[model samples]
Target: MNTKLPKLEPITSEWMFKFINNYELQESLFKSYESPINIHSLDAFSRNIKEYQEILATYNFNSKIFFARKANKFQNLITAAVANGIGVDTASYEELKQCIDLQVSSDKLISTAAIKSRKLLELAIKNKVLLVIDNQDELDQVAQIAREYNIKAKIGIRISGFYYEGNKLLSRFGFDIDDIENLLQNYFTEANEHLFNIEGFHFHLDGYSTSQRGESIHQTLDLIENLNSSKTSFKFIDIGGGILMNYLRHQNEWNLFKTELQDAVLENREPLTYNNDGLGYTNRNGQIEGDLATYPYYNENSKASFLKEILDTTNDSSKAVYQRLEQLNIELRLEPGRSLLNQVGITAARVAHRKVDARGNHLIGLEMNMSQMKSSSADFLLDPFVSYNNPIKEAEPVEVYFTGAYCLERDILLKRKIELPQLPEIGDTIIFVNTAGYMMHFFETEAHLFKRAQNLSVLGRKEHYTFDDFKTE
Candidate 1:
């Protein structure tokens, strides 16, 4: 391992440690399932769910946690979520259909697709799953489908234009809160009541800000209060998920990385990332500019404590947000995709080849593609474990970049240059910890006719897991 590098070591689960340490098992699986493989554990996922449940219990508020299915496409995790007394939040027709096929109850399935299609609306109406209407067109389609089915389709109106800290949060989705009066007067008419059952108000924000969440809840609460009457009422507030989760083990490491990255971008030090790409920073005439585009991998408060911070936010009347929900008998609903999958999965791939680029940089090729382990972030910051297949000989330390199987020049697996005590031999396994959320399959593809990585759900201890314990995809 390179001790001189500003390292962001991962805070891994016991399952990850056990699995990565077992070279024999990893090698056997690689041989069986091909090079790159994704392994998941329900233990961490279930534990995360219980933590949220426990925290909500402390507030004495009726809460619902829906596992956002868009984060990962693993069906086993969806089934596991329903079994744990939670629900599934799907964003597409196939996701909703698969959940229903898995026999998830109507109350435990919700459709929050950004672009709702007629087929999706029909399925959601038939299954009675709550469909969050984004705009008037979508609401009209859903209403028409409900009328065709001769049933009241359960619905939640997605609200946007929430004011946070003096700025109106802009988003293309959802109806403007300023137009709520007009919306209620026109679209939500008495005739529409027979075609729609307004269950609640829903909103999804982009960034992670506790204050913004608090302000949104306060605003939504005001809307529900003003709109509630003999004719209509809301039972829940679905805050679509942006809950943060910590990945790195040390805050100082993340801090040092930022400083070093700025120095590298300013030409004060050697390149930290491959080609000194700066992740998201730019050298603007001897000054670094642009915000870091990666996820905040090191958080002091996350998961349950993160939720607690929002619930503890006080309204204008000095009542806590949770207290308001409790007094109003409102269900505080969240669709957390990444946080619930924290520490739940890892990606493993085999070393393919090694070479030196024209720029004199060392490159080690892996059997996996960049899309197999990628997200919207500029790069994944956690360091990976190299499971060497052979014994260590007298070797010198080397710093190299990991490359992927794609033919494109931008197919670098990890932007940061990794330092190792020695160069890995062919067939050595490189394991990326805590990748179950958006890293493993969010943007994966089958380009170049390369088969997609296989997924396996594992159970039991490292020493006790058998082939039979794996739920294959």
Candidate 2:
């Protein structure tokens, strides 16, 4: 049977289209490389940082924006953060050391790793970077280190309130609400208050629910109010970043596609071959039930304006976050990872060849593998744009699945089949946009000696690009 696939349009800026469509630039970049390459725009990165700063400036209370360093491993991004005088949020020893070595001020760093080593704790204490305490054991370890060095451990207690779906706390990163009193009594005594310093509280969740974030802030505020008798002084409330990034332009189309996919799957349609059982749903008592792991590819609230909504949001009792922060005299600290890196980079690969599969589905093979673009998400839902060195006018549009050079049959670069305006030819470029976030390097690998994709910085009006190898290592 013939199946009609759902089409997704990516949300992009005009400059991105112009930059990718520049035939001369594409020719120069693809001249030497036979594989994939990641082209990052430093200008875009600067614009995103400035936007966040502008948003934070709108509030009367003191606020800080910390670029979550684990989002992308590119050193240039970290350098940009330091140059702009913004803070950097690191999670590993190497990430922390890299920022310090790059001359990022010690005060402008925060370590929030779930598991930190003794050496990392020592380095953090020595450099005066803020350490977000995860648990009591880790807190004790930090206290010991601080005592050994004759310094107070600068810390913020990470706490978890109620999570979504009325479920138990989803994150394993923070302290439970009930544990706060015991913690304060045990650690904030006259004897040990000199050993550790409680600066504030922090909480991070997986989803980008503004209401939930506001609730967390309220819960943290209540916790602080209860600790008024304790010697611990709180200064900031770090609602760790879960800002949403919009990848798809049309929400209605996205929903329509999901419905069509389910219908097609249940109807046992043919001719549409999907990797991994065609979207994977569960059936129980004639009812289809399963949580398909899909991203909010088309969110109404995006990185550009979500912060405004968050700050303006009111709790169920109608208390605004800005008002709460103003009343508490507490600073707002944010550690955005993917949201900050949105629209800052793209991944391009040269089409090695094209052919028809055994099931008559058209297939286009690229020199790169799924690892280059894979993140924690099950699949990247946005459709990749095609950039041609030489334009071709086809009588009919051709639909095909993009495959990779990996030996495994499961190595599909894009699980969703895409339709190209014309049949792709050798040396043509397949471009994935807005990938500067975790998608660029999180799950990247040098498997099969592919040497991994080289990262190039598009500098100065996109006129010149340079390969920055040292940033990755």
| The best candidate in terms of TM-score | 1
Superposing all C-alpha atoms, what RMSD in Å does each candidate have to the true structure?
1.7, 2.7
Q: lDDT tens digits, residues 328-443, model 1?
A: 88999999999999999999999899999998878999999999999999999999988887747788878889999999989999999888778888888889999999999999
Q: Candidate 2, which segments miss by more than 4 Å at Cα?
A: 32-34, 163-168, 268-273, 276-280, 283-286, 315-317, 460-473
Please state the error at residue 270 of candidate 1 in Å.
0.5
lDDT of 2 by residue, 1-473 (tens): 54666778887765568656765666656675546878676777778889888888877889988999888888888888877768999999999999889888978999998789998999999888999988888888988998899998899989885544466656777888777888788667888878877889988887878877776777777778778655567899998888998888898988876766555556545423354244555445545567556666888888757877777767667888888888878899999988878788888888999999887778899989988898877678888888876676653688888998888888888777787788888888888898888887998988888877777665445333333211232
Give each model's whole-structure lDDT: 0.89, 0.79
Model 1 clash pairs? Answer: none
Report the error of model 1 at residue 274, Å. 1.5
Best-performing candidate as measured by lDDT: 1
